[model samples]
Target: MIEEPKSLRIGPDVGRRPSVEQVAAFQGVPTGFVVDAMFGVGAMCVDISPLDTSNVQVAGPALTAENRPSDILATLGCLRYLKAGDVLIGSAQGWQGCAAAGDRVAGMAKNAGAVAFVTDGPMRDYDGILEVGLPCWCTGLNPGSPFGTGPGQVGTRVMVGGQPVETGDMIVADRDGVVVVPFAKIDDVAARLGAIQDMELELDAEVRKGLVLPDPIAALLDSDKTEVM
Candidate 1:
């Protein structure tokens, strides 16, 4: 493991971000579809989830932070760089025993014009966090506060939930899970997302019409690739 920084390594606010309207169009679309459109391989985070798992979705440009275990100073430092429609993505190292942040920080993010806050660690002040009403995503809940120690990095690529998230990358998250789109790939993926949605809608219409199994499934079921005694 690399030694932690003696002080914060704060970089300039990232300039690249996904098109707002294009990202907003992804609301209510399952993350699985976006992941598939990325060619089944891309910056998809694992394990973390929306704080409100039922009927909540978030999409915005990432503003990343790297936090030490049980410490949030780095996370807090990143707040200075927040912009409207930004999603704060913190690499909490998947620590669950201590809060990644609390309602106070959540409110700060809201005040700073952030669209949401996400981490692979837990957060405290559950009721207050809800009251603040900023969309939050994490592994779970923890009541203990994290230390405000030095040795953190901000505004850089950080690994959270097993994926690399660079500042200004697009983040689309819903009940299914969070997906990160590299800054360079946003337009390319957005270009394909519509076709995926169209296909899914067609399949959905077929299911509603009582058509059982689409052509792909039917073909697979009858193909020589399958055999049974």
Candidate 2:
């Protein structure tokens, strides 16, 4: 029997990264609280909400004793394209492979290279993952992650779980967590997001100083009867 592909599809190198502003504008907190320090394994997504999930897709790397995708190798290869402070914010598919522990991948990532790893699944090697100083982002910790058919195919748009990830994409990660951008839209998005972030920081400073505003946002918050948090 012939296997059919999933309706949602993406190709590698489509060229675009979600701008910080774009993602921030559409950001929503996950239904279940995600741990600040998770194993960094499951998958990656725009939001846990039903409306915000579909953003990027990632096909995980295939692994085995002899054919495992090396975190060190991928980091070395990715470094040529990424800066020392750059981030890798796509989804992972290792959860599909239950044979090996998540630590193996985390170790690879921690010791491998790049800023850090991000996923929506479980993660292992908490000690090693943290020790490496590769700040990670993930949903939860899965003891083991499964494998996929193969590795990145040069810009193939594969959904790590809910989010979409393409090859050669720019990623932004910080205390709030990780964000992935498509290669095509990095400049425009980054520039815009910079502005938004600055504005927010400015507002945050004022709020800290007891600045009060009956602005539209305040009205909405005052009127809202229900809150998720």
Candidate 3:
């Protein structure tokens, strides 16, 4: 039997990932409530944007269909922290039988009540796992896994969907995209992200109104513009 490598082993914070958990715990939330609490709201584009899960469908003799899933243990270690309205998308990573591992994780998310898994890669196993009813996103499908890396330290920071994921991190996904939220300094970072979003939004509105926000950035305009200059 091949022994699991310690280089990228799963730890205790499987359910909420890692960074997400810290944000949730920091915010004094129930962890499960991070979603409703506005966790995954704005992190859409960066989500599946980094993924590529394409050939995830299967074809029978006459009927062709997509393969979905629900493999719980492969997802959250205990799943006690999962709740409804949660989304768990897969991120792309190079590993042995990697697609299958991601598929298994996606299945687990659905079974544990997460909304979906956004993988940039594909899975080899399908058909049987489609009933979990969870959504998935990726580039193509393959039935292999490298499995040497992912989040190593439970409850620590790692990337998912091109964004950092935490244990209590809020995940929101749709056809539009996926996102990980409630950054570190939960109560503070979340507000900061919100402010940034607002600033961007206001900028967009200003552009439409023919009123651009003042460019506060000053450029050093000469080859000798260094501080010494």
Candidate 4:
């Protein structure tokens, strides 16, 4: 007979992490810019939004946890894995029946050195979380509580906000949404960011000067490619 599964399974810590300089490069950068750097991908679903808009905007390597529906054992376990500047990504498999985290959890995450908490499921203890002052992003709020029962995993790959997230992946979030940069693509994305920022800045300047249409769109409208009926 097969042995019963463990109540909790904590995977090995991430073997690789983005360099400090690389991580710093993403600090203060908007989620939109990160998406552009990745060629219009990497953004999480829009439904996961900041709990406190004023406290939005954070970038850090992820410490992932996977929990079952109406449970938070994995999230609680993941806290010990947090490093300074880490972002705790708690996955409830998009379940919203109960809270995935709350004020006490947020306080624990902060004490563990996590910069932010992101969850695909809803959360509770809104006022307490705000008082704890830990940045958080979630689908919404629920007053219901969750169980601590296990069959959960920590420091493992998880799907959150409809995106596959790994422990070492870089997570960037703001008022717009969360974005995940795969660990393998961190350097490549960072290399491309400068050019993207330059282009965006140039366009912003042109828009300030009362430019009506973008050059590409204008060219398309003028070309034979356009047929007016």
Q: Which candidate wins on TM-score?
A: 4
Candidate 4, residue 213: how far the Cα is off, in Å: 1.1
Give me the runs in candidate 2 sitting further than 4 Å from their true place.
1-101, 110-112, 145-155, 215-229
User: Model 1, which residues run further than 4 Å from truth?
Assistant: 1-5, 12-15, 19-28, 42-46
The lDDT for every candidate, in the order shown, is 0.83, 0.41, 0.41, 0.91
lDDT of 4 at 202: 98
How should the candidates be ordered by lDDT, best one leading? Answer: 4, 1, 3, 2
| Best prediction by lDDT | 4
Clashing pairs in 1: none
Candidate 3 per-residue lDDT, tens place, 90-155, comes to: 334322234623445556656766555554445545653455445565544565543433223333
State every prediction's TM-score relative to the real structure: 0.91, 0.51, 0.46, 0.97
> What overall lDDT, based on C-alpha atoms, would model 3 receive against the true structure?
0.41
Candidate 1 vs candidate 3: which has greater TM-score? Answer: 1
Task: List, residue by residue over 121-224, the lDDT tens digit for candidate 4.
Answer: 99999999999999999999999999998789988899988889998899999999999999999999988888999999999999999999998999999999
Question: How much RMSD separates candidate 1 from the native structure?
Answer: 2.4
